[model samples]
Target chain A: MSPIASNDGMRPWRLLRAALCVFVAVCLLSPLVVVLIISFSSAPFLQFPPPGLSLRWYMLLFSTPAWMNSLLVSVELLVPSSILATIMGTAAAYALVRGRVPGAPFIMACLMLPIVVPGMITAAALFGVYRGLGLNGTLTGLIIGHTVLNLPYVVATVASALRVQDARLELAAATLGAPPWATFRRITLPLVLPAVLSSLLIAMILSFDELIVSLFVSSARVRPVAVQMWSNLMGDFDPTIAAIASVCFLFAFLVLLADLALRAGRSLRLT
Target chain B: MRPIDRRIWLLLPATLLLTVAFLGPVGWLLARAFTFPQPGFQNFELLWQRPVYLRVMGNTLLISAIVTPIVVLLGFPVAHMMAHGSARLRRWLVFLVLVPFWTSLLVRSFATAILLQRHGVINSFLIGFGFIDEPLPLLYNLTGLLAGCVQVLLPFVIFPLYSAMARIDPALMKAAATLGAPPLRAFVRVYLPLTLPGVMTGATLVFISTLGYYIIPALLGGARQQMVAQLIQDQIATFGNWGVAGALSLVLLLATGVLLALLQLTVGLKEIAR
Candidate 1:
C-alpha cells in the first residue's frame, strides 16, 4: 500500500477526504439506526429520542394478525422458491461451466435477464399472465415469481465457484470407475457445497425482500411481509412499521452471519 | 451425426422454468401493445397523444439523470478510501456498506421515511440544536425522493469504482508526481481516465435503476414526482388498461436495452458480469 501523504500542502485535502467519508457513512447508516431506535419507542407515533423505551410496538406486531400472517406468508413463499431456485440454478451453472455447452455466454446472459430487466416490467408481465391462469393472489404464484427473480443470483454464485474448481478431479473420478452420478455426488457436490449453501441463503433473503413483483401478484389475503410493509407505510406513520422493519433487518443480519460462516477462509467478492 | 451432449439435459429444468414463467409471459405482455383491443398501435398512439404520459416519462428520465451524478459523487470518496486505506479500515468500510446493501429496500425506505418525516429524527435534532424554528418539509417531495434514492444506490457505484481503483497501478500516480505534476493535477489528468470504465458502468446502473423505481417514489415523493414505473402500475391496477401498460413496458425495456448496448460498446458487458 502507498504511504499516507505527509506534505503540509496535502493536509487540507486529507482532512476534506476524512470529512466526506464521515458524511457518507452517516448518510448510509443513520436511517437504519434511527429505525432500530424508534421501533422500541413507547410513543404512539414515530418520535425520535422516543418518549421512553417499550416493547408495545413489537407486541402489537406479533399480536396483529395482518403482520403475523404476512410474516408466515413470507416464510412459506421463500422456502419453496429458494429451494427450487438453488436446485435448478446449480444444475444450470454446472452444465454451462463443465458440460462444454456451445453458446454458453449467450445462455448465461439470457438467464440473467430477470435481474437486468426492470423489476417493474417483470412484475407487470407476471401480473398479466397470472390473471389468465388464475394464479394471482395465490401462494403458488408468489413462489413461481420469486423463483424466476432469484434464479440468476444462484447461477452466478455457483457458476463462479465451479469455474475455480479443478475440472480434472471429475475426470479422475470417472477414470477410476466411479459412474457419473456417483462421481458428482462424492466429488463435485462436496467441493462446492459451501457455495451452494451460500447461494441458497442468498436466494432466501432475496425472495423475502422482493417487493414490486409481490405487490402486483399478491393480494391482501396472501401478502408477504414486504407487501404488508408497503401497505403499512402508505397508510400509517406508526412505530409498528418500524418494528416490522427491524424484524426484516434482523433477518438480513442473521443471513449475512450465516453466509460469512459458510464461506469462511475464502475471500469475499463484492459483486 | 455426433450425439448431443448429455450434460445439456442439466440445463433443461431452468430453461423450462424461465421459458414458461419468465420469457413467455413477458414476451406475450409486450406483444399485447399491438394485439390488445383490436390489434392496432393505438396504445403507443395513446401514449404519444397524451401530455401527462409524456410528462411522466420525461420526469422519470430527468430524475434518473439527476440521481446518477449524486450517487457517483457521494460514492467516489468512500470507494477511494476503501481502495487505498489500511486493511482494518477497509474491513470496517466493507461491513458498513454491506449491511445496508443486504437490508431490504422496503425496510431502508421506511427507515428513511422515519428520518425525513416532519418531526422525525433529523428535524427534531435540528430544532433541538436551534437551527430552525419550524420543522422543514423533508418528506413527500423531491428532497425526500433524492435522499432515498441516493442512499440506496451508493453501493451500486462504490463497489464498481472500488474494483476499478484496486486494479489501477500505483506507479502511474507516482510517475505523474515525479514529472512534477501536483496531486490534484495528477488525479484529474492521470488518475481519472483510468477509472472511466467503472464510472460508466456505475452511472448506467444507477440511471437505469432510478428510472424503474416505484416504491421509493410512492412512499416518499409527492404526487408531482410520479415516475414511469408508478404510471405503469396505475394503468394496470387502477384502470385495467393492459394495452397502455404494455406500451409503457416496451418503452422502459427499450431504454434499458439501449443503455446496456452503450455499456457493452464502451466497457463490454462481460466486465459487468465479472
Candidate 2:
C-alpha cells in the first residue's frame, strides 16, 4: 500500500499531531524520571532537582535497622513463597494440561480467584483466618499468603508451555522403560524448566512488592519492605523511601531481564 | 489407578494450599459477615442504609468511569503512534509503556504524590514560569487521584489497543481513500471499528482495576473521596467492623463480576485476557 501523502494543506496538521504525541510521551514518562531524580536528592524533604547530590540516602536505607530488617524479612518471605508457588504451580499446571481434567477451564478460573478479588478482601479475610489459626503476624503466614497470590502466574505460564510440548516425548521416555517420575524428570521437566523459572522470577517480584496481604498477615517482627514503605508513606513523607523505591525498581528490572534472557535462550534452543 | 486418575494427584498439593490459605479465608470472611454482628442480612443492608457507604460506592464508580475514558483518550494517540511508527521508535515507545507497567505501584503513586503536592514538581514549575500566583491544590483532591490513576493505567490501555491496531490492514484505509473518502472519514469508518476489541479490552481492564485500586486514592484523594476499597479498609482496619467490611466486599465483588460478564458478553473472555 502506498503511504498516505501529506499534501501541502496537511503539513500543519501533521506537525501538530507530532507535537501532541511528543507531549503525551513526556507526560507519561515524567513520573518515573521524577522518581529517579528525587532518589538521588540529598534533601531530607521530598524535593525535585536536589540542591546537592549524595548517596547517603541509599546508604542510609541499607544501614538503618528498621529498613534493613524489613528488607531481610522481604527476602526471607520472597524466596520461600516463590519457591513454594513455583512447585505447586508446576504440578497443578501439569495436571491441568496433561491430565485432561474435566472442567479444567472452571478450575483454572477458580485458581485465579485471588487475582480477580480485591486485595483488601483477601487481606482482611486472611487476617481473620490467620488470627484463628495462630498464623497471624508470622513469616510462615506471609509466605503462604504470597504463594497463593503467585500460584496463578506460574500455572498460567507453565500450562501454556505445556500446551505446546509434544506428549510423544514423554511417551517415548516411558516406552524406553522409564517410570512416570523418571519420564517427567528426564524429559518433561527440562522442557518446561524455562517457563517455570520465568514464573518463579515473576512470583518473586510480586511477593517482594506485595503490600496489602503483608499488612494483614505480618507483624512488626515479620514486616515486608512494601508494608514498611506503606507505613512510612502514611506516617511521614520520608524522602529516604525514594532510595528504597529505586532499589525496588532495580529488583523488578533485574527479574524482568532474567525473564527476558530465559525466553531468549529457550527460543535460541528451539531454533 | 488410571493414568488420568493418577495424574490428578499432581493437582492435590496446590489444591490443598489454596483450600487452606485462600478459599477457606475468604469463605470465613463471608460467613462472618452473616453471623458475627447478629446474623442475617443486616450487614448487607447497611451498605444501602448508610449514606457514607453509598457515597463511597458512588465515588468508586465515578472514579473508574472517569479514569477509564481519560486513559483511553490519552492512550489512543500513543498506541496509534506506536502502531504506525518505525521499528526503532515502536521499541522505544513500547519500552516507555513497559517501564511504568512493571515499576512498583507504590513508587509510581509516590512519584505522583511529589508531582501533585502543593510545592511539588508540576506546581513549582508552573509557579517558576509565573503561570500561577499560588500553589494549586492538586494533591489531596480528585485531580491528584486521577493523575496518579491515569498514568498508572495508561499503559494497560495502550498495550492491548496497540496489538489490535498493529494487526489492522492499512490497505483498507488506502482503499477507502481511493474510493474518494476523506482521510478522517476513512480512519473513523475503517480503523476505529477494527480496533473495537482492543478498546473494549483496555477499557474493561482499566475500569475493573480502577474499581479495586486503594493506594493511589488513599495517598492522593481527599478524605471525602474515599473509594470502595478504602471503605473496606476503614471498616476492617479502622472500625474493626468485619461485618460491614465483608458486606462492602460483596458489593464490590458483585460489581466486578457484572463488569467482567458485560465484557465477556461483548468480547469473548479470552480476548480481553489477551
Q: What local lDDT score does residue A51 receive in model 2, on the 0 to 100 scale?
A: 81
Question: What does DockQ give for each predicted structure?
Answer: 0.72, 0.62
lDDT of 2 by residue, A160-241 (tens): 8898889999989889999999999989999999999999998999999888899888888889899899999997786688
Candidate-wise lDDT, in order: 0.91, 0.87
Report the number of the highest-lDDT candidate. Answer: 1
Candidate 2 error regions (>4 Å): A1-20, A175-177, B1-5
| Candidate 1, A84-194: lDDT as tens digits | 999999999999998868888899989999988889889999999999999999999999999999999999999999988889999999999999899889999988888
| Residue-by-residue lDDT tens digits, candidate 1, B88-112 | 9998998899999999998998889
Task: Look at candidate 2 and tell me the lDDT of residue B188.
Answer: 81
- Provide TM-scores for the models: 0.97, 0.95
DockQ of 1: 0.72
Q: Distance (Å) between predicted and true CA of A181, model 1? A: 1.4
Best by TM-score: 1
